[model samples]
Target: MVQKDMKLWPFKAIPTADGDNFKKIVIVVTYKGEEKQFALEEISSMLLIKMKQILETYLGSEVKNVVVTIPAYFNDAQRQATKDAGVIAGLNVMRIINEPTAAAIAYCLDRQCTSNGATKNILVFDLGGGTFDVSLVAIKKGVFEVSGDTHLGGRDFDNRLLSHFIAEFERKHNKDISANRRAVGRLRPALDFSCSITRARFEKMNKELFQDCMLPVQMCLRDAKMEKSEIHDVVLVGGSTRIPKIQQLLQEVRDPHVFSLHNIPPAPQGVPQIDVWFNIDIDGILTVSAELVGTNNKNQITITNHSGRLSK
Candidate 1:
């Protein structure tokens, strides 16, 4: 069940390598006093089933159809695996959308557009829990054109931190906890044994990883055939974006234009604030409407076409 001699699945291969040429991955687990073998997708399905139950409970309805968001760099096989996981969980996978694309859509829908109706080229820097994606998106007349993607993210930083502390723990206490999962887990919770880390030191430790984040940004600009100055806005998405160093690096890339779209500024006194609302219907059409708080002034745009070719 280990398939130790078989080649590991190449999930990151662009234009994913043909699955037929590789052996399937399986793992053995003891269940009810018996050994059971399960494929990787089956295990993934089990997790998805639990997630579905939670979602159903929250929504108070039986759910079936789902739209899965994946990393922008995911190839056909990876996307198909995601769909299969959903299917195995007893849900119909409606559509697979790129994570960056989805973030860009939400940004466009909620953003306050200039009255001139000029097209804006925005860079989306999405560094989520496990994967990072950078996309150069051109929003014109409710259409989105995307470019660039990446796979590095917050998990790499966590791994680096863990390694640093483990080494420190070994030096101080003369104990090797690297091979001890329980010890490592305890260390992660509190680092209880008189160890400390400063922001500067933490940033220094992961300096290379921080610098690597810029590569995708540069690639996105080149692939889009646009200069850094052309990026009207730099939108940061995901929890990892809150990192000060990450924000600083983004500012260095797009100096004055770097801003978190998630932060809503307070409206000035007596000023009529525009309330923008976004809604995506069942058919994948996005409708954005804006209304003046104290007046009847309103405008709306509906994006019917969600398909676009990413820059190569």
Candidate 2:
């Protein structure tokens, strides 16, 4: 919400369990000479209301049931807060789902994109604006299980950019622009004429942050009892995944060999070479290469799911 030219936003954090998560952020709005306080839940409710209005306009009817997705790392308080937002929005939220789990379900189950009677391990690297999550999910037998991290995300990258830009500005003008909101607004547009940091420059400036992106992924994989090489496919989800640097960091989730299907186990001795090779392309189709044990014969097949979509 805004009054005059000033916008309302969360101004302070309210601690939740473990002091790592926020229960409810404090939203402060200054109107006249007085300040008003609102819970972050209220802000969420307002957003939800607007979203519902948009959906209703499109469908030309009332839509109530909602399956809201939240970060996999949300604590019980945060999850309940989201539900409260739904109630305030006048919508019946049927379920609160982990964002990564929802992404995996949509990518595989809803689309029926899975292999034929075979289980596949998936690494879901979700890099969002505020929070990053790395989920190791196994989809099989009509079930899915996941392990994830909630503390890391694109906000870290954003901070890196801010620091780099601010340093460049300070070096040129010898002034601190942190408190200068108007100047900050012009930072991106004024880039061409200024010392605008390039992607490579930003990556170099914040190398630690770039590498930190993978810590959760490695932890989740260990928890899931899987090796990175065993993952059949890596699904990229969330807006932060759009960054080239982020994409590079997340490619580890993708069977870097998925395109080549080179996770080969040794063949038995005293026998001709037999190879099991499968390549999973961006289209989610898996193509397997099978070499006959004796001669120079090669066999291959394209695997698809019930919906006629390529198995991820």
TM-score per candidate, in order?
A: 0.67, 0.68
* Runs in model 1 lying further than 4 Å from the true structure: 1-21, 26-38, 112-117, 141-151, 189-194, 256-312
> Model 2: which ten-residue window has the lowest total lDDT?
1-10
- lDDT by residue for model 2 (48-139), tens: 99999999999999999999999877889889999999999998999998887787798786546665767867677777866777777777
Model 1, global lDDT? 0.67
Q: What lDDT score goes with residue 164 in model 2?
A: 67
Residue 271, candidate 2: alpha-carbon lDDT: 50
- Error (Å) of candidate 1 at residue 86 is 0.3
Error of 1 at 79 (Å): 0.8
lDDT of 1 by residue, 1-312 (tens): 113211121111112223576666566645576767776678778988998899999999998988878887788988888889888999898999987778777776776543367887778888886678788776664324343334467766766777788789899889887766446656665556556788789999999888888887887777767787777677787777767667656755554432212323466785647688866565544455777666666666554322211111
| Model 1 TM-score on a 0 to 1 scale | 0.67
Highest lDDT scorer: 1
The lDDT values for all models are 0.67, 0.66
Predicted structure with the largest TM-score when compared to the true one: 2
